[model samples]
Target: MAQKDPVLALDNQICFALYALNRAVTARYRPLLAELELTYPQYLVMLVLWEQGAGAESARVSDVGARLRLDSGTLTPLLKRLEERGLLLRQRQADDERVVRLLPTEAGWQLQEKARQVPARLMCGLGVEPQRLMALQQELRSLLAVLEGSAPSD
Candidate 1:
């Protein structure tokens, strides 16, 4: 029988580290979002909408899905919940009824004001410098690109 390599242990896997970090970061966001009656994924959708500006026109559902890396199967229910809460509106496009558009409602815009401190609080809680965090994000983006085969594999 061959002995298992210690180098192949779970703790030594980069994928394990990434998975653990994702869980930890999402856990940190849980309570903060609970105050606003949002889950982390919902908060992410709102963030994308919020970026378009409070009074900005509606965005196509496909566009939102692309930005968030979510499929309709996943995004639809979240959008529905936000809609039920009067935080956003999902409408069929006039020119192309097959296409759906999403826009933040007045309540959604107001929620943004309450969410303004989330990032700062997260940074403080994590005790990480913003510059370092940004650098890490850039590195992760490159890693994802490689994983997705958009970047050359070495």
Candidate 2:
């Protein structure tokens, strides 16, 4: 049998860390969301809509997918759920009907205060400062670019 590289060990894999981090974060959000009867993905969509919007300048499902590394098959269904919850409205663009725009409803903004503490709460657990977080995010972006058929230019 051929031997595997020591560096390829599971303990050294970033995917394992990412998986664990997601699971742990989801666990934290679960109890918090039970009060609002929302799921993690739903909350993610809300976060996108809050940060973006339903219009071109606001948000579209494709834009969300791009930012989240998802696709329409996954995002379209989630967008439907958000629409059903009255958290947002989904519609085809007037000029470009092919583009689906996701606009948050009044209820979505209404819940902002409810979740206002979540970002800081999660960050506190990660124990990374804002500037450090930005640096790490940039590194992750570079890593993602490398994975996505594009080597990040320095």
Candidate 3:
């Protein structure tokens, strides 16, 4: 039997580090989000909505999906659950029957206040300097853009 290459080991893989870190971060968020009755994905969706400026809050379902890099198959069910929880509303556009728009409910808007401190709390828990986190986030986004841009050619 051939020995496995050291370069192929799990501990040496960047993907493994990313996967483990993602899980750890999500685990850290679990308890924090539970207090607001939100799952991590739900909180992400809410973040997008909350960031939309005044009078421009509603977004097409496709738009939301695009922003989150999600597809209807995955996003639809999450939207439905949020709607059921009275956190958001999904409606078909009057002019475009095929277009579905997502609008946060008053409750959802109210919940934003409750969630305002989440980032700070998460940062404190992470024990990373804000500047370092921002730089790392920028690097990750750059990596993501490169990966996404290369996909069709692959």
* C-alpha lDDT score of every prediction, in listed order: 0.90, 0.80, 0.90
What would the per-residue lDDT of candidate 1 be over residues 26-131, giving only the tens digit for each residue?
A: 9998888999999999999999999987567777778889898899999998899999999999999999999998889889999999999998888888888889
Q: Which stretches of candidate 3 lie over 4 Å from their true place?
A: 152-154
Task: Identify the leading candidate in terms of TM-score.
Answer: 3
Enumerate residue pairs that collide in model 1. Answer: none
Residue pairs whose backbone atoms clash in candidate 3: none
lDDT of residue 153 for candidate 3: 72
CA lDDT for candidate 2: 0.80
Task: Tell me the lDDT of model 3 at 5.
Answer: 85
User: 82, model 1: CA deviation in Å?
Assistant: 0.7
Selected candidate, larger TM-score, 1 vs 3: 3
Q: After superposition, how far is residue 90 of candidate 2 from its true place, in Å?
A: 1.1
Indicate the TM-score of model 3: 0.94
Segments in model 1 whose C-alpha atoms lie over 4 Å from true places: 149-154
